[model samples]
Target: MKTLKIGNTTVDTVLEWSGNLFDVGAFWPGRSWDAVEAERDWMEPHFIAPKDKSKPGVLAASIHTYVIRTPRHTILVDTCNGNHKTRKTIPPFNNLNTDYMEKMAALGVKPEEVDYVMCTHLHLDHVGWNTKLENGRWVPTFPKARYIFAKTEYDHWFANMNGHAMDGSFEDSVLPVVEAGRADLVENDFAIDDSIWLEPAPGHTPGSVCINLVSGGGSALFTGDCFHHPIQIANPDWSTQFCSDLAGSATARRKIIDKICDTDTYILAAHFMDPTAGRIVRNKDRWKLKI
Candidate 1:
């Protein structure tokens, strides 16, 4: 649980769950087991999965949300998977039973106090908390908050409602927010305030974006799925199999790495394990995450 202040705004994390779920070799397709094994000492316990029958060797991840408290508003970045969501494609994420709200409350943030909910992309894990089940009906969890969604990202998934990418999330979590008239579809570079804004970093998904926070003199970048594991920070061209456009994802990742590496900007990864936020640095001719 780390917190940082950017000028007048403070950013904190409320974790839902953290553990390994995917095999390391398979999670990053084309990656060699040797490369993964070499990083064992650094990845173990937090990022690496213990050997098991289901997935013998995999990389675990943290599922959580960032609470951004500005002087005038409270904003949340990327709601983690919610309880009772039907995600059959990934059984572990399906019908989850985590005390997400309790954790949110522990942060002194009631759902009603949230002014905006921003999702870097509408993936199952990222948008599941947008709505919750109540009395047999799905409704916006943060009733007072306007859910900010990139128009390009929403349109693509809404049009292909049944696409695997949607994976029933559009119908269950996202559509309900829109139907409830709480969705604020905006452009990729939309700004929420003088110190907060969205930056286009499409590739992993059509509308994928990053939330930027700059207050006082501090700066941080809440990168969505643009870089899942810190390993990707060392190898910007290593696009995950889940990326819709491999080349585009690599290009975008490289560009971001170049922009933030060796700077004060903190890279707030969406699925990174504990101590998820850190800065990138130059490692010889490559890069590394210094958490």
Candidate 2:
């Protein structure tokens, strides 16, 4: 709801909601449902406790838009959920009706003024609003921007675009944009401009990446889905039960945490609770978010 400047970049946290309802002892691996009560307690102080654990974690359909004011051009990282898309299996993300464009306009960011749009991944929630409905067709949301995608991530998702049929995210959240000629697929550590770069961060999804912004005598990292909660700041090993590759993901999370803990970088977690962006510090031998 507010914009904060990090040197040459402006990070706007456009979020829907932030809570730890989903994994509060109620969530588990595919069939590994035995609640780890102690770990849950370890996670308590780091998360917002919801009375009801029967429901999924309530999250806002929001996007963290980054406006990089560099000498070259302007880039917007990640568009939030758009209106009227086919509902997802999750309740919180279902039938979203928020006005994302209006919020962008309020911040004086027009689609045309945006020269590039970068997506950390192509998940239904992450890339749902990357395109817009125009005259009965889904077109690139940013008319003048070259939509960037990780080459590996794009290929895998594109290959299975409609193969899954039922849960094919590419069909709804991606293909439309590719048809619109706005997608710009690049490498894992893809560098767009001088101050901004995308680091290869796999595990959450095959081609997951995080955005790094350098400016204002400071730095910030837009951790796509690497560390969803600040609790991960304490227990980086306690990955979500649904993570694709737990070991790989944990390694990546540690790497980023180390970099931020040592540098002047702040984190912009897409799903972190209040004090969304901050530094990482060592608590004993473990890491924690220094809010």
Candidate 3:
């Protein structure tokens, strides 16, 4: 486990899994490795897997949750792919099991002790852990926590429940929470306290948000899918195929780069590999994440 401090708050990562999961070309359609060849030095082995003549270039990614402890609250930002869920479209995440809860226990926090469960969006991977299978029925994983969801984001998925576009997560992982009355559908700009709040960062999903945390003199942004890989730092215009709105996602990516570039604020991207938290800096005319 890796711990980070933002002023008086403490943040830790509960990793589900990580690896070179997707081919670079397929992840970002039409984008080639040459576009980011200049960054091969730092990208290899983490962001971009080393090249192999037997296969296409692949991008490294991690699925995990951030456990944030403020002076007054214990918060979890984006629940990673939960265990035993069926993700038909995303075969990599289907009906799997892992020691995710044990990892949380090692951090000295139990599921019931969590004060809030915040989802950046309602995507399958981001919300899978919202519920767990118990006796063949899905139930809220955090028995006593309030699960927060953006109103726009929730409504979008809620209306499309009849379909299976999201790999059946809307029904299995999210609905159970809502039916249990543990869901909080708030505006995109909802705030939790003086040090934390939500900021609208649409494009990846209509209701996707960036959770902002400011305390004492330290600051960090939990960017959910804003930039899946560090390569986006240099190529802000390359939106992944998963983004609901490609152009909007690209614009949001640029906005995030502009907000953190050459600054002390840390970026905790959802899918970035190890040493996932870092600051964006200017490299001549391009931007790079200094981890």
The alpha-carbon lDDT assigned to residue 1 of candidate 3 equals 34
List model 1 lDDT by residue over 74-124, tens digit each: 999998888898888877788898988988898899999999999999888
> Which ten residues in a row are the worst by lDDT in model 2?
30-39
Show the lowest summed lDDT stretch of 10 residues, model 3. 48-57
TM-score of 1: 0.94
lDDT of 3 at 92: 83
Which one wins by TM-score: 2 or 3?
3
lDDT of 2 by residue, 1-291 (tens): 346677756666555434334453423233222322223443343343443542333322224455555556777766655666675555556666776677677767777888888887776667767777778777777788888899998887777664321244577667877787878788989887668899988987778899888886878888877876665676677566545678877887988987788566888776665546678877677766765
TM agreement with the true structure for every prediction: 0.94, 0.84, 0.96
lDDT of 3 by residue, 1-291 (tens): 379988999999999988667677888999897776778776665566566621356776899999999988899999988999877787888887999999999999988889999999988889988999999999999999999999999998888864433888899999999999999999999999889899999999889999999998989999999888899998899888888899999999899988989888999999899888999999778888888
If both were scored by TM-score, which would come out higher, candidate 1 or candidate 3? Answer: 3
The candidate with the higher lDDT, 1 or 3, is 3
lDDT of 2 at 74: 70
**Highest TM-score against the true fold, candidate:** 3
Stretches of model 1 off by over 4 angstroms after superposition = 40-56
List the candidate 3 regions with Cα displacement exceeding 4 Å: 50-55, 162-165
Clash counts per candidate, in order, are 5, 5, 0
